[model samples]
Target chain A: MSSGLAQPRIRIPRSARAGEAIEIRTLMEHPMESGIRGANHAAVPRNMLSRMVVRMNGETIFAADLRNGTAANPYHVFFVRLQRSAEFEFVWTDEAGRSVRATARVAVS
Target chain B: MTTASRRALLLALVALPAAARADAALEAAMREAVGPAEPEEGGMALRLPALAENGAQVPLTVTVDSPMTAEQHVVSIHLFATRNPTPGVASFHLSPALARAEVQTRIRLAEDQQVVALAVLSDGRVLRATAETRVAVGGCLG
Candidate 1:
């Protein structure tokens, strides 16, 4: 298992119409080694993000299960609609059971 | 058993699954995830560059034509990298509240391979689109 600092980033509009759609972009930094081999020819144990959950005001709007095939510093962008002001929480979990989280707030008009 | 013979046996065991072919494994994974439904041609789109100078961070976008209503919406979206160490890249679950069935992300491509995006709808229909990308340098192994 590889242990390193993970940084999660999210982008959401500061405000939106009550019923309008908004795009949310997210990214996280991790090594995501494939467990194949490194330059020294030693087998590198796989370290990858396994799950991502996005919640809007305590309700899950999107969730994903990632795999080793994902590249390092995985990035995701998706859309969501809200009827009122809410906070969006993003949680990412890796293969080693480590988790990192980030949050963004949007004001619905 | 002789050391040489044991080494040969280990190599043979490793080569067995490696020789099973990559396409077949990918197909099996797709079938397992999305079932046997034949994905329609439209209702989904995959955007990726035709040529990628670096496969480590190939940007990808997938969009499904949906109204984001409770009755008709995309249930899930699955991404696959055909030539990666594993076929299943990621699976996303979405609800009607999303308003739009579009997602974007960065992925790694092992080599010149097809990156497929499959979407399943609430109405029990499947849609798919694929984009072929030629990578000058591999991402996973490099």
Candidate 2:
């Protein structure tokens, strides 16, 4: 198994002004391999770091389908409109049918 | 044989079986986690550090491009490491109302190996992505 590690360290403000959009920044460690070739001349198996969904106050904010063109350990930043304090959830999936998840909360002032 | 030779022989005999057992256990875990699945191109992204000096605390992230709409969303995500002691890193289940399709965390890379990600949508469509990482020695050697 290639370093069987997870990705992305996200930071979210604990609180935000009401009705104001809050910033959500995420940094994940990834190799983001093109899978053209593997180590030691062995054919690298096909895998993916595809699909991410973000929710704010239980509402979907952003989602995407990624590809080989993406760089390793992808970094993403986005904003969500906040009306009140709510739990933010983030999840990601890979090609080998694996998944990693994390959560953060923000208070709307 | 001298005492030193006898000790060396005994050590080898003991070490051989322990190593073999560990290898077998690891293999079984990999087979159970990784099933027969073709690589589906597109719809996923992996973010990793440009360079990792340590393999034990390598940070990783997986993101899938999907709308968490009532009609559509990501159901689950799977991660695999081909050369690690344990290939299956983690699996995630999403709540329909949660609607968050991205996950992030730190992982232990046994060595420098390619990592793969797969996402299953509520509609049953699967998306995939991959990334190769370099882990320095003395970092993941343990």
Candidate 3:
């Protein structure tokens, strides 16, 4: 498990047309250790982010429940159809019960 | 039993728990992600190396045949490994503009396992693929 300080960096375009589709990308710094391997064939407990939430204008757009096969430093990309300018919030909670949140603003044109 | 034979037996016994745990986690993750999608044999193509010298940063790519338009598009792609701690790899959401219905990335595999990739279509149909990989020691073995 990573230290409590790590968090995902969320990015959303500053401005988007009211009816245009926008791309959202999220990147997190995590070891994603499987906890099944060690330097000398020992058992390590699995550590990874279990869930992620993406909200647009306070409406949930995307939610994911992650598991062991996830790659280290996991990166996720998703798209949402923008209806109006709003604040997009992305948050993730790992299996260790740590939470990190980020926000991006999109202006409708 | 002789010392060498005893050691071998001990190792095999130890492996049982890890294997069982991996199997359970993989099953649970699959159930949660895509419930009973008629587990296909190899409908999707997984492009990964035969042997990963470094387990920490193995490149993984998955592609499926789909026409990405307003009519029908791939809604998502999920990656999974049987032996990895989380069993569930990363996932991506696609749109028509993505053009190619493919995803590429670097992943960590603790050891060999049946890697499964799943694709959910716009019409709520699920397609899956699997690949077996042999992993070695090198990455995140702290």
* Best-fitting candidate, scored by lDDT: 1
Index of the highest-TM-score prediction: 1
lDDT of 3 by residue, A1-109 (tens): 3548476776678887876766676788887656655434337566778777777678765666665455677776555666667887788888878888888888888
Instruction: Please report how far candidate 1 places residue B31 from its true position, in Å.
Output: 1.5
What does candidate 1's lDDT look like per residue over B56-114, in tens digits?
A: 88888899999979999999999998877678888889998897999888888878999
Tens digit of lDDT per residue, candidate 3, span B1-142? Answer: 3488456656755788665655666667777767766554454688888888877777777877876676888777888877665576766666664445766667777777677888888877888887777887645464
The order by descending DockQ is 1, 3, 2
The number of clashing residue pairs in model 3 is 13
Candidate 2 C-alpha error for residue B31, in Å: 8.2
RMSD of each: 7.6, 15.0, 8.0
DockQ, per model, reads: 0.53, 0.05, 0.23
The CAPRI category of model 1 is medium
Q: Considering only chain B, report the TM-score of model 1.
A: 0.83
Best-fitting candidate, scored by DockQ: 1
TM-scores of chain B, in order: 0.83, 0.69, 0.80
